[model samples]
Structures are given as structure tokens and as C-alpha cells.
Target chain A: MTNTILVLESVVLVLLTVLVAGLLRSHAEILRRLHALGAGLDPDAPTSELASMPVELRSRVSGSFATAADLDGAGLRDDALHVAVVGTRHRTLLAFLSSGCLTCQTFWTAFGEPARLDLPDDIRVVVVTKDASEESVSALRKLAPPNVSVVMSSTAWSDYSVPGSPYFALVDGGAGRVTGEGTGAHWDQVKNLLRQAADDASDDSREVRIDRELREHGIAPGDPSLYRTAEQIAQESRA
Target chain B: MTTTLAAHGLAIGLPTGWEGRIQRRAVSVAAEQTHAVVHLANFALPEERDDFGGGVTPLMRSADVFVVLFEYGPDAVGKPLFATQGIPRVTADMFGSKRLQRPLPGQLGCQRFFTAHGRPFCLYVVAGSRAYLPRILAEVNGVLTDLDVAP
Candidate 1:
């Protein structure tokens, strides 16, 4: 009877050891996954929403911007061009990137120029970096598209809500709301969505017959930012 | 009782010993802080042997990339320590050898880890001071030992 009891006890101890070992191993895997963005980073989630946004919002999001504090720094620079900035009455695409981010550089290479081409002429591409120096500025100039206007600011880190090295947001400027935000570099999806939104705004305007009227008056809808209202902008050119 | 790291087919095992979920993908990597990893994989094939020389030479054959910051010891100064176990020796001849021709004033070292010779290389960095060198190597070796590459 004693022998039988001893054998049973040994079996329980072995099983417990195995169970505990498995638990710890599983725990370690969980920790690793947490470190790696909870499985893997998804870079293609937001590309389809580009065409559904409001024009004012889209224009502002994609237009050149000046954080209040950065304007002061730009004023201190040698070449202080009075760059055009869109007002905050609509949605815009705000991108935050770091000089040290390799992924940003990679994504930038794939999407930078092509992205600019897809945007309406008025939807300017703007970038805000954490530090602005002559050398860094020069490097950025080489990397970004011709249509891009880059800004260097110490306060960019704080103003951008850039929780990570590279992040992006589609903001509804009129509503003062974030339409969408992502933490990684997903250029294809972002470009597609932005293109779609631009197309939708254009399509919405086409239905109103405004393009012919603008032609008759000999006024081109030169700047998407200058128009006060979406209806007015969409209607002004209609016949 | 003692926690020792182990590897099981691309996934590292905890000291407690559990089965891993071999995702068979290169993980994203970052240095010290605020870097995010995405699951997109892009790999370019090296046509010539000289193409992947120096720091640019990938540690693996597969093109998937996983990033990690590599750290090493103070003793590794002036010497090129091969971080990957697959290639025991990475002589200057393999690369053009022009870049490291004149070693810097202080200890100049490189740090990285690998699962295979031509796959995604993990992140590693040897920056600033030699103070953290020993701790960095130990931590890296520990992580590497835990990784198991399947045949």
C-alpha cells in the first residue's frame, strides 16, 4: 500500500512540474508579443477612407501647417519664406516622422513622390521634424518630394501627439476631431484613402455643375484653401 | 528554479520551458525607445558577393527583416567581433575594408543577432560608452541562445 501511494505521488509531482513549466513559457511568449505590437504591426488598415472626408478638412490636413511656436523659429532662420498655410476649417493629413526612423525612410521612398502626385494641386504635403538644423534640413529636402514643405521644431514632439517615432493622423479640422490615427508607416493604404477622399470631394462637386460657371467667368479654382465653404467652392465653377 | 533562456524554431523559449508559436516571420525591431514595428516584409536579393559587405551585409539568406539594437563589451574595442554564429569569421577582405581602415580613437564595435545566415536580422547597437558593453553582450547572447532555428 505504501509503494502504491508513493508511485501516485511521484506522478502528480511530475505532472505539476510540466504544467508549471508550460505556464512560464507561455507567459514569456506573451511578454514578447506585447513588446512586438501585440502580434505584428498592421500597416494597411486605413487606405479606403480618403474620399469620404470633407474638403475643408481634407485640404487643411494635407496643406502646409505652422504650429504657433514654430512660426517664431522659422522667423529666426535666414530664409523665411512666407509659405502658404491652410486655415483650420476642415480635415487634413498630419504626418509625424523622426530623422532616425529607418522605417520612415523606407516608407517615404516608396510613397513620397507618388503620394504628392495623387493629391489635388492644393493639397500640400507638410512635414514636422523634432529638430531643425541646416544639415538635417538639407537631408530632408533631398528625401522629400518637390511639393513637400518641411518644418523643424523643438515642440513638434509635444504638439503632434507623436507617441512613437513615425505616426500619422487624418484630422477633421472643421470638427477639431481626429478622423483616423495610426502609429506605423502605412503609405499605400494612407495614399489610397486620401486619394479616395479627394475623388469623392471632386465627384460631389461634379454633380452640381459648377465647373462651367467658373470657366464662363474666367476664374480658375486656383486654391482649394481660399474657398470659404464647400458648397461655394463646389458650386462656383458649375454652369 | 533557475531561469535560463532557450529557443524553439524562431521563437525564443522562456526559462520556465513552454512550447512556442513559431510565427515564421521576421519581427520588428527598435533601438532604445519609441520605435514601432510593422509586419510588412521587403527583401532584395544580392546578385554579387561583394554587394552585402560591411555593415550592410545581411546576417541571413531570407529577406525578411526583424530589427533589434545590438550591444557589446568594452573588450571588443578595435576588434571586429562577428555577431552571427553562422559565420564564425567575417574578415575585412569580405568587405571593401576601406570604411574601417582607420579605427576611431575609442573602442569601435558593432552589435547584432541572428536566427539564420540570410533571413531577417534582429536589432543590436553598441553606442555611446563602453560601460554597458558587457551587460549588452550577455543579454544578447542570452537572447540568441534562446532562439531555435528549424531545419
Candidate 2:
């Protein structure tokens, strides 16, 4: 009888473990949904491990900015783009780059000719590099395009949690949040990523509008009208 | 929205549709002293420009405005023009054609000398048209309001 009881208790303990695992998964899903809805993210999340690698790109948070202050060896150039700026109304693409990285060469050239990259006319592109202490101002000035601004702020690298050299973050100015961020091997990949993120953001807004309209018409989510009945589906499929 | 750009012991917040740069020429000769030159403009700046803005000032449209903060040698620190002793606050009324270093038709310019952070500098402003002074100066003032100099 004692052995039987022990086996029963062991079975119950295994069941309990499975139950806890399920609950944990559900909680994770809930957190993921919350993040999708723009909730509970710390914009000031500390710099990540990726910035140290200087070869991959990852996403990060808010940062500081300073310009017109470090033109000592910059020659005739106006200012270096080693600034950390936040965009409010316009979509700003923060290219967290390093002066010493060879991977950044393509991006620098692409940004100099942003029009050829097929970016939207409204996007404001800026490059961010480490502060003067870690970079060569003259070299950066040489690589910097006459039209684009290269902000030099080490805090920007940390603010965005950039681990290494060439990473890109697309900050939605209207939403005031990073929509998508990752590293790309070249400008084409980076441009496509940005375009895709912009498209996704717009689609989300479209869905939200549709949802609002349905509610305004007294049709809540999961309403019968939102989904066709089996008979209607059959008829549509047949047609 | 404004972008605050701080470099070379100088800082300024550039307003929307405006850009600014601070540059210091290295002392190429022993007799020549180094000083910072800041250029702020509402329109697009060209690739080439002198310390006094000779190349770009001519491109200003009727509603455009150009500002230059040209730092002078330390010897001019105590001069009467530099006696104001701080970043000068610009008023629309302070600009006139007579103050232009090289005046051109339809453009009115003003110049102010001041010392900040023990450095003497000239604040020169040019408005494309006097009729647009109020609007032009308002934008210029908004940009300069964020001006700073660190020792």
C-alpha cells in the first residue's frame, strides 16, 4: 500500500511539472503580445553584448547627441555625424557604424546616394559612430558624405545597444519606437529590411483601423460576420 | 523638431529645415591663430564655404537666413565689440543692411561681437529680404537659443 501511494504521488508530481511548463509558455506568449502592442519595453535598455563584436547589428534604445563641438582635425568639413539624435515626426534610420570596420564601407557609399536605394522620400538617414576618443575624426570626415550627417557619440552606440560595427535600426518617428532592427551585410539587405518593417507597420495600422471600425459598428472581435460560416465558406470555395 | 549638435567647444540646436556646422582651421602658420567658425542656415549649405560665408550667402532666397559665428584671436577678448561677454541673443531689429561686411542687393546683414569662454567671436546674420526679417530672424533666434560654448 505504501508503494502504491508513492507511485501515485510521483505521477501527480510529473503532471504538476507539465502543468507548470504549460503555464510558463502561456505567460511568455502574453509577454510577446504585450511587446507587439508597444508595452513594457524600456527605451533606455543598456547597451548589449553585440556592440563589442563590431560586425553584427542589433537593436537598442534612446541616447544623447553633440555636434559642432569636435571638428578639431576634421579639416574643412562642417561636422561629424557622431551624434545621437531621436526623431519625433519623421522616420529616422540610425546607422550605428564604426570607423574602423570594413563592413561599413558599403553603407557609407549607399547613404551618400540614398535615392538609388529606393527609400521613401520622407526618411531621414543619419550615421552614428563612437566618440572622438575611439575614432579618427579626419578619417570619418573623409568617409562621411557631404550630404549626410555622421553623429559621433559613444553613448549613442550604447543607447542603441549596438555590439559591433555595422548595424541598422529603423525608428518609427510617429510611433517613437524602434519598429525593426538588425544587421545587414550590405545596403541592399539593410534597405529591404527597412522597407519590410515600414510595410509591416503600415499593415498593423490598417488592421487597427479595421478593428476600430468594426467596433464602432457594434461588431466585436470574433463576431460571426468577421468569419464566414461553414456553408458560406463552401459556397465561396465552390464559386 | 531640433537636432542638438555639440562639437569643438560649441553647441547649437538646429531647427527643422535648418543646418549648422562648426569648423576650426588648423594653424598653418605660427603667426596665424586657430579659432572656431560656426555656420547656421535655413537652406541647404554648399560643399564649399569660407569662414565668412562668401560662397553660400549668395544662394539665400528671399525668405532665407544665414548666420555665422566666427571666433577671433584671444587678443580681441577685451575689445569693446567683444565686451558683451556671452552668446549674443539675436533680435530681428538688430539686423540691418549697414552691418553687412559685403552687402548685396535685397539682402540685409547684421554683425555682433562678443566673448564667450574667453574667446572672441563675431555673430553675423544676413536676411535675404528685409520684408522677411521677422520670419527669418525668428528661425535664426530659435536655432541660436541653444548655442553654447564650453571652456
Candidate 3:
């Protein structure tokens, strides 16, 4: 009886070990595939890192790249110019989306509706889709918002290094640089991101004004008076 | 900062606050290489615009700048109208409201026909405000410096 029990125990142990090994291999393979698809495991990583990321907002690497890719129309015969994202007088919002994504539907509907965006500011919005090869043109045509420009450019996807759908990039045409970019599942979440970008811009302008005033008062960088401790600042303020 | 937009061997550099695109229109699944159109502007461009800014120019605000680079058949190259060897350096005086495709108020338009890089092309520009013509033309010229011909 004892010998039989030992054999049975060994068999069970072996089976368990094999199962664990198989599971580990499967997990590793899944991660590898995700990585291959440009999906980043970390939220703090670059925009493309989290390709098709969850419906959450993440502040991206500010000024990650100096310029954005110019958008060329993919499968459309319309007279739309290959839209440029840089060097514009006003702001432009590039929405990277797909026709089939369930998460993207909310956005399409929101943008397609005749109602205003009620966005943080007045901005030109453009929808970009992968080449017709990867996306369904018929579905897109049905979903294409009358208010926004839809361009089917696979090159634009690779050029922008977009990892997944439902991504947003705000381009300051005057500066011709990406002021803000990230992924959002819905318009409400995306709207907050735009608001945050606007706040950051406002903050930057305020800082610039403060710095100019200080310089006008003859206080430059590394000035001793600027390095005063909190106590000194409090005392001066009190005075 | 400036970004370069190139396609079909034609390239142009866009300066800060200037956005534009290059395209060879596709009739079906296959893209057509003929009649490439390049549009550059210093204002927000609407998606519904025609090659000549049908939906966009009407929305231009004061001080906006729009440039259109319309490509023609290679046969159009070296014609008297396109006799210029390279993209002509646009001067301020070359612009006037009369040159506009439509007589829009407070706008000035300039058109130049030239050949560059073995291709025939027309360079069209519209100034949103006539008072800012010289300054806007200067900005347009700054960007045109990077214009490339075929290949």
C-alpha cells in the first residue's frame, strides 16, 4: 500500500509540473505577441508602447518628436489636400481610429453627430484610418463623420508611430509640434485630455510672462535673489 | 521647427505654423500617380476642401496663408507658361486680389507656373489679409526653399 501511494504521489507531482510549465510558456508567448504588435506593458512608456491601450488617459512624453507626419489621403477621391499637421495658424486634433473597433464607435458617433464637440477649444479635427487594405472602406464610408476629415493612410499610421486605434494627438500649428497625445476610449475621457493640454499651455504662458517680468527687473537665471529660502520669501511677502 | 513632406520625388519643407500635404489621387484601390496636388496652409484646414481649397479658403481668418502646388502632366513641362526652370521665387508685388480664383474680400492671390524636377506644376498662394501680403509672402518663401523636384 505504501509503495502504491508513493507512485501515485509522484505521478500527480509530475502532472502538476507539466501544467505549470505549459502555462508559463503560454504567458510568455502572449507577452511576446503583444510586444510584437507594439503594445507596451507600461503606461508611462511612449504612445505607441500601449497600442490599443485601455480606455484610460496617460500623459505622454512631452515633445517626444519635434514634428508630426503629414497626412495623405488614403482611399478617398475627395479634393482634400494631403492635410498637414504642422505649421498651421490654428490647432488640429488627429484622431487615429478604425472602423471595426467597438471602442472607436463612441468616438465616431460623437464626432459624426451634428451636435458641437463642446471641446476645450476651437480645433480642427481629422480622422485617420489605416490603408483600405487593413480597414473596411465601406464601413468607414458609412461611419465617416460629415464634420471631420477622414483620410485613409497606412503611411500616416506608421509615420505617427500609432500602435492602436482611439489615439489622439493635438498639434499646435503655430509651433508645428505635438502639444499633447494619448489614447482614450471615449470622447469624454478624450475631452479631459484636451482640457489638460489647454491648461498646460495656459500654465506655460503664465510662466513665460512671469519670467519676462523677472528679466525686466534685471533678475536673470542663477540670480542670488531668486534662490532665497522659503523664510526669506515669506518675510519679503509679509513686508 | 520645419518638417519635410515628400512624395513621388517631389518634396517641400514646411516651416513652423505651416501645415500641408502631398498626394497622388487614387481612383480605386490603386493610386494614380498623375496630377499630384500639394496643399500647405498657415490656418486650420477643413477636411472637406477641394484641391483648390473649396471648403477651406472660405473659412480663412485674417492673416491666414494657403498654398497649393498642383501638378500637371509631364508634357506640360517646358511649355512657355511653365518655362521657368525651377520654382520661381515669389515676390510681394506678384500678389493681388485680382489674381484670386474668386474675388473674396480682404484676400490676395498669386499664381505662378513653373517646371521643377522634370515635372510641370503651378504654385498658387492666397493671403488672408492684403495688408499682410509682404510678410505672408516672406513666410511662404521661407517654406518653398525646401521644394524638391522629381526624385
Candidate 4:
């Protein structure tokens, strides 16, 4: 009888140890999952990691810029003797420059080389300089790229509310809006501005297209159904 | 030497030497969520120009100041501050208070945090020269203290 009682006690101890170990393992798994969810929601998470997550998990971020002063009042050149900014069907890069600005001179010197600028083909480059006599701007005109349009406008500076020389504005002709505007002290900054504007334009076009398609199908782009399928469609299309 | 500037239910005094402009837009973050963003640009040295590098630098290339007001939904109350592109993260001491700063090239940068209203806002200021940082900070501190946000 003594031997049997000792054996039963040993069996109970073994069973209890196994159960505790199992509970600990399950708790560890739960903790790991919680950590992952926290990391996914972290704002500082890397772009690559955010991209891999589902769209619903990623939040939307937006930005805005001050309204650019109207260019209509700006008396742009339209004479046969000089190139005019007659609006283009595609996006236009309106580079505000002045002969009096040393910074503007640097930009013009670099802009004279089309190969160096290497702007996307879809974007049309137009240089808007202060209205000056042909003789006054003759030296600056010679530095302009052959393919780019150079226009002289008296009100261009104030119309755009340009803070300083070598300011740039990305004008979306189709939308009739200034997509992006800022001052660039170097040629590389100008290139970056163009690239960013191009990306923004592309995104805008995609959204517009999606909205139009949804409207055609008798569904509002704001409808919940559209969003439900947007991510899946975006994933498939991207793939 | 100051002018009254107002936007997003808030009003403040702007220095006379600065050119203040505001932009407002409605942004759709999710299908069921949409909010407004107010962007303000203050040009301190409109005539001066500086060579600020590209890629992560904020706008107002040469000594300029910018203020961005972001409105978040009720759900964002407890969330971390959303990281904005092009603004590098930094630690700085401002007016005897320690705050996280986002310093861009050319000494142009901003610092942002959630306000009492649960809205994320940023104040960006650029000095014409490094020597002007102290003066700029004082001015920025005044603006922050004087800001009147609508509840």
C-alpha cells in the first residue's frame, strides 16, 4: 500500500508540470503576436515594412501649400521675337528667375544644358524672368536651353508671390492648379521638385480615373464597396 | 511690427517683415474618413536666397518659416505622431524646454507634437544665418504661446 501511494503522488507531480509548461508556451505566443501588432502600427516603422502591411493597417497622410497668386494678371511675353508661355497640354514647369539674383544666375547656367537637367518628357519647361529689354536680358537669354521656352513677364514675380529668385512652380494645365511650388537654390533641388510633382500628378490621375470608373458603374467613389475592393485591385495591379 | 493672421479657427500675430499665406484643402484618408489640412508659409527673408540641398529639406529654401496644422480623427488620440516625409528627426532644447526637432538642410526645419485638442501641428522656421537661431527661436516661442486654437 505504501509503494502504491508513492507512485500515485509521483504521477500527479508529472502531470502538473506538463500543464504549467503548456500554459507558459501559449502565453509566450500571445505576447509575440501583440508585439508584432504594435510594431505594425508604429509610425516610425520603415517604409518597406509599411508597404508590406495591408492598406487598412496603413494610415493616410496629406499635405497642403499656400495658394499661388494668379498668373493671368502677369503680362507674359507673347511676341514673335520671343518665346511665350502659351500654356501646354501637359504639366508645365514655371521657373521664376531674375538677372539681378545671383542664385537665379546659378540656376540659369545649369539649366542651359538640357542633358544635365534630364527632365521627364511629359513635363514642359518654361523659364519666366523679369520683364526687361532685349539688350538687358541678352546675356541671360543666351544661357537658356534651346528646347525650353523663355518668357519675360513684368508681373510674373509678384503674381506668383515668389519670395526670392530661382523659385519654381509646377502647374497642372489640365486641372488648372499649381500642383507644387517652392524655392530651389540648386539644380538638384529643381530636379527633385520635378520628380515629386510628377509623382503627385500621376497619383492624382489614378484617383481621378478610379473615381470616374466608379461613377460610370453607378457607384460613388466614396461608397464603402469601392474601398473594400480598392486594396485588392491595387495589389493585383501592382503585382 | 506685426500683422494679424487667422486660419483654422485660430488667429495670431505675424511679424511685419514676414509674408504670411495660408492654404486649405480637404483630404480623404479613408473611405469613411476625411479631414482638412491648413498650411501656412511665413517668408522672413523674401529677398534672400540660399542653396539648400534637396530630397528631405522642407520648402522655403532660403530663410523662410512654415506652419502646418493637421487635424486627426478621434481615434488618433493615443497614437504616435505620424512621421512626415522629408523632415529628419532630431532632439533639441527650445526656450528651456526639450523637444524633438526635425532639422532639414540649410538650417531650415520644424518640430511637431499633438496639441491639447488632439491635433498634430508643426512649426517650421529658417534663419538666414546660424547666428540668427536664438532670435528666431524667441520669435517662434512667442508664436506658439500666442496661438489661439478653437476647441
Predicted model with the maximum lDDT: 3
lDDT of each: 0.40, 0.69, 0.76, 0.51
DockQ winner among the candidates?
A: 3
Task: Report DockQ per prediction, comma-separated.
Answer: 0.01, 0.12, 0.22, 0.01
Query: How well is each residue in B1-151 modelled by candidate 2, as lDDT tens digits?
Result: 3467666788787765566667777667898868777877766555567777788878778888888888888789788878997777777678777878777888888888888889888998888998898888777777767787887
Model 2 residue runs over 4 Å out of place are A1-84, A87-89, A112-115, A136-142, A230-239, B1-21, B27-30, B39-67, B74-86, B95-111, B115-118, B125-151
lDDT per residue (tens digit) for residues A1-239 in model 1: 99999999999999999999999999877755533432223444332232223223234346443232111122112222111122233344656665566546744565455444465533334455666652266566566644344445445457645676456555444444444445443455566656655565577568556767766677567844445697776786793
- What TM-score against the true fold does each predicted structure earn? 0.29, 0.59, 0.63, 0.36
Q: Compute the TM-score of each model's chain A versus the native chain A and list the values.
A: 0.42, 0.61, 0.69, 0.52
Residue by residue across B8-99, what tens digits does model 4's lDDT show? 45555554333333323333454665333433333321111122212213434443444444555667655566444222222234311122
Superpose all Cα atoms of candidate 1 onto the true structure and report the RMSD in Å to 1 decimal: 23.3
Clashes, model 2: 27
Comparison by lDDT, 2 against 3, better one: 3
Predicted candidate 1 versus true structure: per-residue lDDT over B1-151, tens digit per residue: 1122222223342221111111122224643222111110012111111211223233222212212322222233334343354412222122221322233333223423332433334332222224433443444355445544443
The Cα error of candidate 4 at residue A80, in Å, is 6.8
Location of the lowest summed lDDT over 10 successive residues in candidate 2 chain A: A64-73
TM value for model 4: 0.36
lDDT by residue (A1-239, candidate 2, tens digit) is 99999999999999999999999999988855544322325545443333222323232222221121111122224453222233233566778777677657768778787668788865667777787778887788788887666667676677666767787777765455667677865676777677667677688789899999999999998888778888998898899
How far does residue A213 in candidate 3 sit from its true spot (Å)? 11
Better of 3 and 4 by lDDT: 3
Between prediction 2 and prediction 4, the one with superior TM-score is 2
